[model samples]
Target: MTKSQKWVSFLILSMTCGVIYQVAYIRFVFLGPTARALDVSSQDYANIISVFGIVAMVMYFFGGWFADRLSPKFLVVTALAVTGIADLYLGTVPGYWGILAAHVVMAVAGMGLYWSALVKAIGMLGDSSEQGRLFGFLEGVRGVTSTVVGFVGTAVVAASVAEAAGVLWLIRLYGILCFVYAALVWLFVKGDDRRLAGLGSSTVTLRQLWRAARNRYTWLIGGTVMLMYCFYTTLGYFSPLLEHRYGMAAALVGVIGVVRTYVFQFVAGPAGGVVVDKVTRSTPRFLRWMFAGCALIALSFLVLPRDSAFKWVALALMFALCLLVFASRGVYWAQVGEAGIHPDERGGVIGLASGIAYLPDAFLPTLSAWWIGDPSATPAVPEQGGGYTALFLFLLAVALLGLGLTTLTDRTRRRELAARAAPAGAEAAPLAA
Candidate 1:
């Protein structure tokens, strides 16, 4: 395929993977109506959500290995198809166990089969020089698609006579969209003959896997992602935070959540990419700045008085925080190229990093629930602000740790690059007779 065609295909694949995988849980984060309709307590919901993370953690390692051996095109297509079917089942609004089972299925389809291949495919679309731009555009476009979907889904929920029915309709709509995207992938995403040929002859060895594990840079990158993800997962609490502390209407809070997820992500994702590529021109430097920004924003949450009179100030700060968080998301993966991982080991490295990085997903929900209290509680209670404050303090600490890790990773990467370059220069020198 031509370079242009490959880029276009990669963008589509990235966006499709981003949107479909998250649809099942979108309501848990953004749509209050759906949460109420389900009649599940915050603790129960947290447990349900944690199941995805638990299953995904185990799947990611194997999935990474599969990406090295299997055709990315085929794996991604199957993932979408399986996830679509699972979404359809969820629309039935089964009992708690059934809903939990559906999430487990989604974990297999989305994280296990799809996530590694999707990242590898995007990495393949461009050389090392283009990593930042390609990932940025992929995330930016995905944010746009997610925003559109959220808006449409919200409208459908608002217009319906029954909130439960509206949520069911939304689930069905997502399932249909997943199927359509799956067909698009099958039709447009071509096979990589060269990659496939290499896969056929060579198996991923234990030694190669050990090398990937032993690399200090790999762990540093993974730790960076993990810390940043703690911040991301905490963002889910903002919906209830605004609702409980400031008495924002549920529907309005939902809209605000969408804006945070879609609008901020759309703008920040690409801009973050550009800054990484142009301004910093170094992934570790960009990450250090990004994490520092997150630390500062999170600190604001801790210091600001939680008075209702300061509601607008709180909202503004939250918006700023979202921008930094989403921007960091855009560029964190670009560090893969900067770390000097070989293409052959990219899948395994990403898998190991992502698996460990996202472990917070398993516990953050439960912790958030414990801190924020039940959503069913009356909003007039005076202590709501304290819970959010504690949460912010936790996030501030995580951000600071991320900043330190970024600095360390940068130092290590620089040393590695210099050592690799020195050998080449020495080899090129002419021998005197």
Candidate 2:
């Protein structure tokens, strides 16, 4: 395939994978309908959602290692097929244990097999200079795909006589879509293994894994991602926040939440990439700015009074926050290229970084539940504001921590670059002498 063909095909794969990967969990975060369908307390639902993260966190390392040695085409196909089958089962609305089991399956399929391979594949589509735009387009397209799917699913739910039935229908729709995408991937995502094989070892070594793990830059990048993701995950609570605190209707909240998920990504993902490539010209610098913006936004949440007069202002601020946060996500991975890590070992590096980065998945949901209080709690209490305040403060601190880590990574990278350049200059001087 030509370069253009390959780029388009990879973007489609990225977009499809993005939508399919998150379909199961989307409902849980949608609030009202999901709460009723699962017939569980907010705390119980949080526990169930956290289980996926726990399983995915474990799988990320192994899956990333496997991506280095295996054909991404094969891995992605298998993942999509398995996830599709699990979605079908989940559509049956099984018991809580059954739901938990399905998420475990999803973790294996989505995170273990699909996530690393998908990321590596996108990285391979272009050179280091193009990393920002490549990842940006990938994320932007993904946002568009997710928004479209979310709308359709929400419509299906709204039109149904029974909310649970509607949710089941949405699940089945996602299952079918997964299968379709799997077929497209098998056919169109061509020669990834051969291409990647030229870039790295066919087999991952323990030493390679160690090298990546020992790199301080890797851990710093991981730290940034971890905190950003923690903040991102907390945004789901905004749906409940709007519903409970502002007296927004559940259906409207779901729509707004769905829009929130994709709108920022669609606009900011590619825009952030362009800015990284043209404006900042440095991933680390761009990331610092992104984190600062996130910190400022988080502080806004803390200061906003919960009055009717401030409702629109708060909503607008929340929307802006999402845009900046998701935009940061768009280009943060470009650091993989900027960090000057070997391409051959990138899969393991990605795995190591992701595995560590997603650790918040294990606790953040439960923490959010604790902070936000029970969704079913009748009569709005003063405690809700206090909970939100604490959550915002925690998020603000997380963003600042990300900023600090990025600065360290940037300084280390500059030192490494200077050290390498110094040797080249000394060697050239001797030849001139």
Q: Which candidate is the best by TM-score?
A: 2
lDDT of 1 by residue, 130-200 (tens): 77677767776787788888888778876789866777787888888888888988888765566444433
Q: Model 1 Cα displacement at 384 (Å)?
A: 9.6
Question: In model 2, which regions exceed 4 Å deviation?
Answer: 1-15, 27-29, 64-71, 117-137, 161-164, 183-204, 342-348, 379-386, 415-433
For model 1, which pairs clash? none
lDDT string for model 2 (1-433, tens) is 6887787677678767566775556743465456567666777777877888899888866776778777777888888899999988877777789878988999988878887778777766766687767775776678778888888888888788986678778878889889899998887776544556555533345776688788776788888889888878888888766776666666777678777887776887778888999998888888888889889988987887766567677778878888877778878888998888887777667767877788888888878887777754654555553588889999999989988887887777777777777867733222200
Q: In model 1, which runs have C-alpha deviations exceeding 4 angstroms? A: 1-15, 65-74, 117-137, 162-164, 186-206, 341-348, 379-386, 413-433
lDDT score at residue 359, model 1, on the 0-100 scale:
90
Whole-structure CA lDDT of model 1:
0.76
Backbone-clash count (model 1): 0
> What's the true lDDT of residue 198 in model 2?
52
